[model samples]
Target chain A: MSSYNWAPGFIDDGDRAQIVTSRFQYEDGHTLDRYLATGGYAGLKAALARTPTQVHEEVKAATLLGRGGAGFPAGTKWGLCPEGKWPRYLVVNGDESEPGTYKDRLLMERDPHQLIEGCLITCYAVGLSQCFLYVRGEMALAQERVAAALNEAYAAGYIGRNILGSKFSVDIVLHWGAGAYVVGEETALIESLEGNRGMPRLKPPFFPAAIGLYGKPTIVNNVETLANLPWLLTHSAAEYMAIGTPTSPGTRMIAVSGHVRRPGVFEIINGTTTFRDLLYGDEFCQGIRDDNELKAFVPGGGSAPWFLPDQLDLPFEAKLVGAAGSMLGSGAVMVMDETTDIPVAALTLARFYAHESCGKCVPCREGATWLERIMERLVDGHGTENDLDQLLEIGQTICPGPFPHAASERLGLAAVPFPFKMTTICFVGPSAYTPVHSAVTLFRSEFEARIVKRKLIPVSIGASDE
Target chain B: MTRLNDANQVLAREIIGRYPKARSATIPLLHVAQQQNGYITQEAIAHIAELVGATSAEVLGTCTFYEMFKMHPVGKYLINICTTMSCALMGAEQLVTHAEQRLGIKAGGTTPDGLFTLERVECQAACTEAPCLQANYRYRYRVNAAQLDQFLDDLAEGQLDAEIPAHGVVARVRQSIPVDRAVSVVAPDDVHEAPVWMPLSGTTA
Candidate 1:
């Protein structure tokens, strides 16, 4: 269990509140002894002392937002399970597959007891009888660490039947998911847990809290979202609210990669911290790599639209970033310096979504792959002028909206808001269109330059033609 | 084609018991099947369907949707070099090219010696350690051409066998939960009252 030597880049400068990551700096932190020594399960003890409604209200008062892609409030999502529903199930979404996002993976590997405690408190509050932890299959170390932690906890009476001598009893099962990016979405995650293709079910009738896994009431919370519960319950909700901005009242982990001197995961004050503070601040990534100037950055994971240098002062708040034509989705910031090739950068993401399309939706399957083909030809200097327009036209078939772009300020085109219109079942279709919309809108000159320098090689049909 | 041996059959039953519905155990059983044989054999797939109460086609459908399950036999070591956006920004493509040249095989091709298979993959969630790759799903981060060469040499010489297992072995640690400690589970229709753990009507904690 102590074999994992943590890679460098987990910052613990003591400047900000390290709620979830406080134990990450210590060796053997994943072990039960280290976890118990570091004030683990104290939250569950404190929570068990209160009524279920009281524990639920305290979490609501703290205003803990989901750290997964969507920033929905955790308390409100818990309250949606309908009061009289018996035998509710809690499903923890540990399948952290979003590209550029690795924060949840760290949480699961470093301090699994904290997450296990969080789940205990949550199941007690939500009146859930059973819990399922769904982790990605590719994360071998994380799975082993969590499994060992669970074995230790069960033997210690932290899990299974009347935990800690309380009337509340719950069972926690760890399930591993095979490789599929679509399962990161909650509904798709539920489908995958049922041993089906990880395709997103339609909303309204299929809302998880009402009718979910095995046709019973279920609540799916992110790994990081539940990981915060232990810390929130150990301290008062007001104490938790005292830190960070009023709206986003807690610290959040942002995984910064790409051309940065210090590319790693750092816990920063939510909403108050700006992109400039993150990229250039001494406590965070110390500016672009090799003294190079920042060209463009994806404010979120690969699904987000690209942001230019002009938007560097924007804060980490969801509303602020959403208003400015992108989102802090998944808290994965990817920076590109002056040496970046814009078309190729866009194609890298385009190719990913194309390869990952579940093929359940035709627009995402066909349209994303179609866009990748054009991007490949364009990058290879074999594209025509019509290919650029074709990329947008095909993208429009998937998303079908005036795309939210940062260039709308300069171009004078009216900017559409967040929750872009989509023709497909889930956001994967629109996710594929984001790179095309961003690259074509902001870096038109780059695409045009590549296409204008198109090279046409003569074809030799037979041996005689050579 | 091969079937699960006596020990794997016992393991398969334990995996199936973890779920309330036998069908929910489909994916895990597929993993066990792959672990038994490098690639999921036709016989294993049929056997899994019988264990999970699913048809063979249904089992195949679920297996094909995931990227990790390989239908055909691969090399002894599976090296996945990531070239996504973050990794691509850090010259991950160049690392892939170097690997291709040294291995003398293209992205999806296996080496002639049947020892190595290289694939240019998407993000491995190790972006900060850009230009990363996974040998049989165990991560090797911040890799350069020299590091890759040394890694390949070590892998070929069995120097890193303890760290990185064969391609089909996901992890050395297997999860086993005894039945008595498990939650009281039944069919969805059988759950009528408030859960046994929840305090009845006006009783306070």
Candidate 2:
């Protein structure tokens, strides 16, 4: 929507990945006419001609997964809604508030029509008549572009009232979330869409696909995941599946930020690209900025644990990264060079989780705030060994794992049951401790170096008060 | 001035009709109300409550949850500086420290003259353009101390006024749905009131 003179993006790296960002390769692709000229809504036309089940089967065959943090299969998610539910809704998760993730922002602003067309395909396939695009509030330019494109679509009969001579009449409402990271969660997004405070609802009773958006069956997909629809529809599922691994097929957008020579979103074939290639290879980041040695990198977004330089040669796939005790979450590679202060970095990421924690669950709400406080003290050089112990203790209490004490020693603490099942309602609980825990574990010396024990004023041990 | 004016009320109603439930319009109406006044006021919240069929406390609760919906007045130009990981790695902290020195106020403080307020934000989603800042929510990429000075000078002399608006007015290009495509006009009794900003049909281009 605005003029720009950024670098020639990572799309130039053709051999590494099929360039899914071809629409964005040109500046004019954001407009409806330009997008149509580039064969954009042709997918929707082809999709509408087929039966809804056929449309569902094609998507299922391709196995395109959600680009949001969950990485759930987009096709399987569509099948979750039970049939015969009238007024079924489609929600486009454009709330890309992940710390190092900016791929959706680029997609929304650079080529919005592809995303809208993707939404139309999903709406038709799912037999849903209404869609709500919950865009982040700060994305003003993206909203403007999408709004202008919607006006064009409305005029061309692409959106609203019987589409392309078909009986299906679909409408999409562009809604805005003020600014809450928790709303990225489907149920919290539903809560935000309902004109209430965005809070993550407890699952099982509130699994969004089965019952969501005012207790109706809803399908939620990320912007980037939906943007891939036109390409998949135009090409055969076999062609799409040939791009990446058998499991995590197709190209994925990776927002490579932090200490990179050319920091921007780079699309890569899943399970092929490694963290080292992303941060150092010519096609991607072109090496860390100032030619410094890469010390550590967040393989995913802020929630991901830091990957040390020695361990970064592993492929960028969910299974491999998960095997390495991290995740390919949101595919945001945030790098930090040798000069970075480990304690400060931990505190910064910890603060984000704490600030965004919606105060809904005790583990996330209390745990995040508590971790942020301890991390701050560590960064400020007033940390004690006890503070480190306290952080681990609190983190476990929020989402307890193996009992820290002996079975015999745990006799009295049985009342303090822990969720050990990943803590709170949302991932915010474990995410809050991700950076803090990782830093304490991987860089113990760094934490110990920052310690400057504060002397407490001597006090009589509870004198006669008891 | 705090209440949605005669014209904006129609726009509010049109937005309300877009959703099955009228209460869903609360967020958009809050934006329109904020634009009318610099920030949301008690009267505007009350007006929005009545329009959306929600309680004042409920509206306030929703408003408070979002960081963008300002409850108090802000400076004419809000300078949101990104100090997150990506930007920090590229020297955003130094820029912030330099900005504090230049402005004679720390981040989140408005100048005494109230022209600009500098805020250290998490990220503005412009990580590629490290050390970026948003003036009145418009992007300023790859900024340094020199750029900050020039921006302030331009702002002080009303040079950047054409590009950047006052705090509350979010978008310079208004959203004007065509008359024929206006969802509000579908029902006469339900939402007959026409929005003032709706451009005549076929003229949006």
Candidate 3:
């Protein structure tokens, strides 16, 4: 099989038998034996050797960021917990349900031992005795694989009391979430884990590090993020950091789907590869299968804003994407070719966000539904000038605005800041606005043509929607 | 026959205990019921409703919301086709047609031999390998009409008798065939009885 240079040292060996990990090279089926062979439980063993403070410092030095949406540094979050807190829980957010995102599913299903190893390391780092792997409910097979791996760890003395004859002890629990897009959010995940409707809670007082699952100190890390812990512990942080960009180190699993010749998940070093490299440089994604021109791309799943083809040169890093007014949200790159109608595609995504909105926030609930309805009307050729304005208005409403002037004034405070200023405030509402704004700005002519012609002019699927 | 095996009862109680209000356990209870019994019969749903203190309609509403919960009887092997945009674009229709033709049944219909049940579903997030299907919860991605044929053949001939490979994006046949033939066997007690169809409210059709 042909191998691609995904990064400086990492290569897509295309080996079906070997499991992909930073330190270990285990054959596919012998996960338990091979994992043990490669000093897999060494991190847990090392963590068990030290105090929780030492473990926390080691992780903090590694600077591992959560591989889920919002790449917050994992160690920093863990260090923020109050001392002497009992029952600190580590939640493995395995709810990999993001559209165009399938990397976590592959990791959880293929090399579950790696994830369990990482979870154990994390539990020891935070002085937590119990950890929960909160997988999406639909992933029955993945859940079973994880459960089997956990059982294997328990049987092999990698988990449970005095793991590896050390003083540390931890137990892993598997919790499946009712399928919902909102449940992927940290607060919403906590709610769902608590067996409540998966609605996101307001921040400030309820941050997961302070008060989380069962109202105790909790840290929720993504599957892929936790999967990196064992490797980080086994190898020096500098060795791992040598692979990727300074800001975003290590390999990121990029899931490329939609209108590609070969669509699958591949792990690429954070800044070494570009969109074109993933999409066009290989026989796998042989550049728009049907000779269609590329229109636009969702750099990160359906939630992230659309990026014009020109922006493909931008580094595939979260910080860089955020600088470009888009997010590397979940690393779900959805490529849309020319044949796709921008209005129709936008309407479809809008409809999804609207349907999945938990109805807890007024702006997101009402605004997203209105945007979907209006965009649907516009796409179907029933758009009026008023409808276009209404669509824009709804998009603005969903974009977190400052509190109303009257409310701010009544509170005797300075002018209220825009909702976008609060980094952790509401990512969903702003995320919902990205595609809408992009569709309007980049495809103004298309929208205008649809309105004037009152019909869709089909373009090549690979042609630019703009 | 086992009067709710220990595992099933434990699963039921465990799911119910997760919720603060016992009434919130209706949906998961119905799922457990369906998993225990091949399909959620009216009696099973009623029993769940009584257990969770929910009306039948309320329980039914929860059941109908998720596509996984089966309201009616399915064949021994359930084949769920992906009908979402990504799969549709990759000729999921052809795969569905091929399945129907090979199985001699429609998309939502079961085989006359009561061996296979095919249904259309929304996106399975395996769009990278578009045109995928889930047979008994194991994903079969990058599927075409011919691959489906090979899979059906392997399944029919009982050649597939290993644990399904848990990961990757390749097109391969996966099987978790039950070890005990007695446990895996789906015996038809009688054939003369009318084909029982549950209300479509809880089903994708």
> lDDT per residue, candidate 1, A239-272, as tens digits?
8899887789898999999999988888888888
DockQ scores for all the models shown?
0.55, 0.28, 0.09
User: Using Cα atoms with residue i matched to residue i, what is each candidate's TM-score against the true structure?
Assistant: 0.95, 0.91, 0.76
lDDT of 2 by residue, A184-259 (tens): 8888998888899999888886457778877777888999999999888888688888988878889888888777
Each candidate's interface RMSD, rounded to one decimal? 2.5, 9.6, 17.6
Candidate 2 segments exceeding 4 Å error: A1-3, A6-11, A16-19, A402-420, A453-466, B173-205
Two-way TM-score contest, 1 vs 3, winner: 1
Lowest summed lDDT across 10 adjacent residues in model 3 chain A is found at: A1-10
Chain A TM-scores, candidates in order: 0.95, 0.91, 0.86
As for model 3, its CA RMSD to the true structure in angstroms is 13.3
* Winner of 2 and 3 under TM-score: 2
Once all C-alphas are superposed, what RMSD does model 1 give against the true structure?
A: 3.9
lDDT of 3: 0.65
Candidate 1 lDDT score at position B13: 89
Ranking by TM-score: 1, 2, 3
Q: TM-score of B chain for each model?
A: 0.94, 0.85, 0.71
